[model samples]
Target: MKTADPPRPRTRPKRPGAPGAHRRRALPYLLIAPTMLALSAVLGYPLVKLVLLSFQDMTRKELFAGTDPPWVGFKQYRSIFTDAFFWEVVGRTALFTVVCVGLTMGVAMGVALLMRQVDPWVRVTMAGVLVAVWAMPIMVAAAVFRWLTDTDYGVVNWALGLLPGADFTGHNWFANPWHGFTVIVLVVVWGAVPFATITLHAALTQVPAELEEAARVDGARGWQLFRCVTFPVIKPAFVMVTALMAIWDFGVFNQIWLMRGGQPEKEYYLLGVYSFTESFAVNRYSSGAAIAVITVLLLLVGAVVYLRQLLRMGEVE
Candidate 1:
């Protein structure tokens, strides 16, 4: 009773705005402030300008005259949406992206599995070759593919001609859009495979051998092993790589442009090339901006999927 009469004053809670509390809460933001500032300066400004430009009817005339183009308020977008050729380009781009992504992931998974099964020296050699391929410049790779698929005296044509009933001599790969796209696909896949392979192989290394062994003990073999155990372990990596590959392939331009000698045919126009051709080649700058904006919106879907995968992985960890 005597001690209760002298009860201690109640302890005060720390204020949210206390100097130390505030600093602790702000430390992370403070650390990231420079990065955020740099990204805003570099990326944010251009994105805002692009959106603004898409709303305006900017042409070569306006660009040359250094005058601000009149705002047309979605006219450019409407024109693009209404164009049949735009839809064709979209469809073709989508088809190309699906094919490329499919082949890339398939071949990459196969190569990764091969690497895991091969002898140590063979695996090292394969990795070295992959690294070399991965480090190659896109320009150099495109130029090499161009030479290989050249209408005359190409090594590819020469090699194909060596087959008993096949004659690829003087074959114009780009004459038929289908044939052209095949070569382009090959080039794209060749350039893409190394990265995907290496990434998948790295992911494969993380797979628990014990799990695979246990699955094998239960009579899981080949596809069953992969589908049940291996694939699940690496699924996160596979999804991330596939989404990135789809996005990159969807915007393919340099390979097509360089292969077609700086003037890709309409049939060859993916969204990126279409946007560039519209802007600089035909002086439809605002229309190009609109197309670009649309392309970015489409790519945002993949980006969202990629982000979600990362978040899910983080939560799992």
Candidate 2:
């Protein structure tokens, strides 16, 4: 047999670090480097500038003239802490966020449930209407609402006047702080409901009809069925919506600014509006920066709490 074919030799596989292996290993990082660099340029740089501005006595003059700003440390922060108006604004912002988000999500969930119970054609129509409402620009909607709540020729007052023993005709909706606040709340809730409803409806669709049927067979009806079966399945969506709405409503500016910019004793001033007024109106750039920092901190606290709850929920699951 010719000496067993001269004893064939075996070849080993290539090591991971050999030639193209190193490039392949580094490819993923290389791909992500641009995104990280862009984020640093867009977000990180601005954030650093904001922090630096907060610690300095930055004014309109210095900002425009390119002069070196004086460092003031925590003086702006101390002024904000000492000011009762700032605390009031904080409290008002908190209350407005809670109420607006609560009403928006509550009504949205209710509407989504109702949509499921309706005929297919009606459901489609309702969904279309909600989408149309959501598509409207915030400023346009605010302006329309402002006009609708007008004292002399508003449709709202005209409609309310029709109610028995009720008089809303010639009513100035923004005449008082509480009244203006209520109108703002209604406007925000109207704009917010469509998004929440659509998200909730999508989440509801993923839930198995069989699970619902099983729960119903076990005498779980209405809220009981929802609480026991539906909720557990869609909890993630609910928590996500809540967190998103909280953050959004907390920093609402355009709607309130357009409808009524901190009118009636500035009772309607949210953190965003307050910061804008401080910086742009009064030229207190440093103070405004401090307020913006505080607002972010508060939002971070809320986010932390939400994350903790989500983690606990995951553990339970």
Candidate 3:
């Protein structure tokens, strides 16, 4: 009976910390907590403040007096919605986005095709040029464009003067709203083309050559080969680039601002410039915040619709 009672239960071996001890499951979260806090401080707080401010009447006095901002409900939104100038800006923004995105994507596709066809050395040179153009800072690009289009001594006017029976000397590009818009479009396209071209070229390089050769064997050449063989392979990349270009073009402020500070009767004011002027210039903080919110919502809706359509088409393909 004593020998049988001495057969006790076996004890488990001890872990590094202690017997049957477990590691802290929150360690990973602890590691990322600092980064999460930083992002919240930088991006989240401002976004929340903007939304809150949009619902309140934030005048210069209220901003400086340290009093509670008066809540205005939808009045600010109603005013903006009813304004004809706001509608005009919306139309202009839409048109600008469509034209710039379409032209940039088309030109980039052509450039990508040319890159595929050219000699290695020529391709390298072209790539270098594109990189240089892309690396130009936006402010620098704006300054350079201003010099190029200067009414008095611009190289553009100088070049135009050489045309037979044509003279653009002293013709102010920024004086006319449409001319200014065209110039802005050109500058934006120049900066944007390099990105689109490089992305499309990278996509093209991933396409299998066998498929292209097969299409060629079946009497497809030139655009036919591209349409049948190359396009489907690169359609996803193309759609992505087109969507991104649309977003960038829609939110373009600095380029327009730097070019002429939204001059020519403020006709060149896109939503971004309009919002900036409304907030900082006129000190209508709530109205500007509303405008910004609306702009974001419009863009979000457009992006969602466009991406859905593109995805459905991709699935069908």
Instruction: Give the per-residue lDDT of model 2 (tens digit) for 1-317.
Output: 55656756777777997987889999999999999999999988888888888899988789899998999889999999999999999999999999999999999999998998899999999999999999999888988998889999999999989999999878988778788889899999999999999999999999999999998988999889999999899899899899999999999888888887444247678899999888888899989988998998899998998898799899998
Q: Each candidate: RMSD to true structure? A: 3.6, 3.5, 6.7
* Predicted candidate 1 versus true structure: per-residue lDDT over 1-317, tens digit per residue: 45556777998888998898999999999999999999999999999999999999987788889999998998898999999999999999999999999999999999999999999999999999999998888889889988988888689899999999998879999999999999999989999999999999999999999999999999999998899999988988999899989999999998898888899988889999999999999988889999999999999987998899889987986
* Models ranked on TM-score: 1, 2, 3
Candidate 2, overall lDDT? Answer: 0.90
Each prediction's Cα lDDT score?
0.93, 0.90, 0.90
TM-score of candidate 3 relative to the true fold: 0.86
For model 3, the local distance difference test gives 0.90
TM-score on alpha carbons, each prediction: 0.90, 0.88, 0.86
lDDT of 1: 0.93
Residue 193 lDDT in candidate 1: 99
Q: For residues 1-317, write the lDDT of model 3, one tens digit per residue.
A: 45556766898677668633444556678899999999999988897888888899999898789888999898999999999999999999999999899899999999999999999999999999999999999999999999999999899999999999998979999888888899999999999999999999999999999999988898999988888889998988988899899999999998998998444257888999998989998899899999999998888987997789788987897
Candidate 2 least-lDDT 10 residues: 260-269
| Backbone clashes in model 2, listed as residue pairs | none
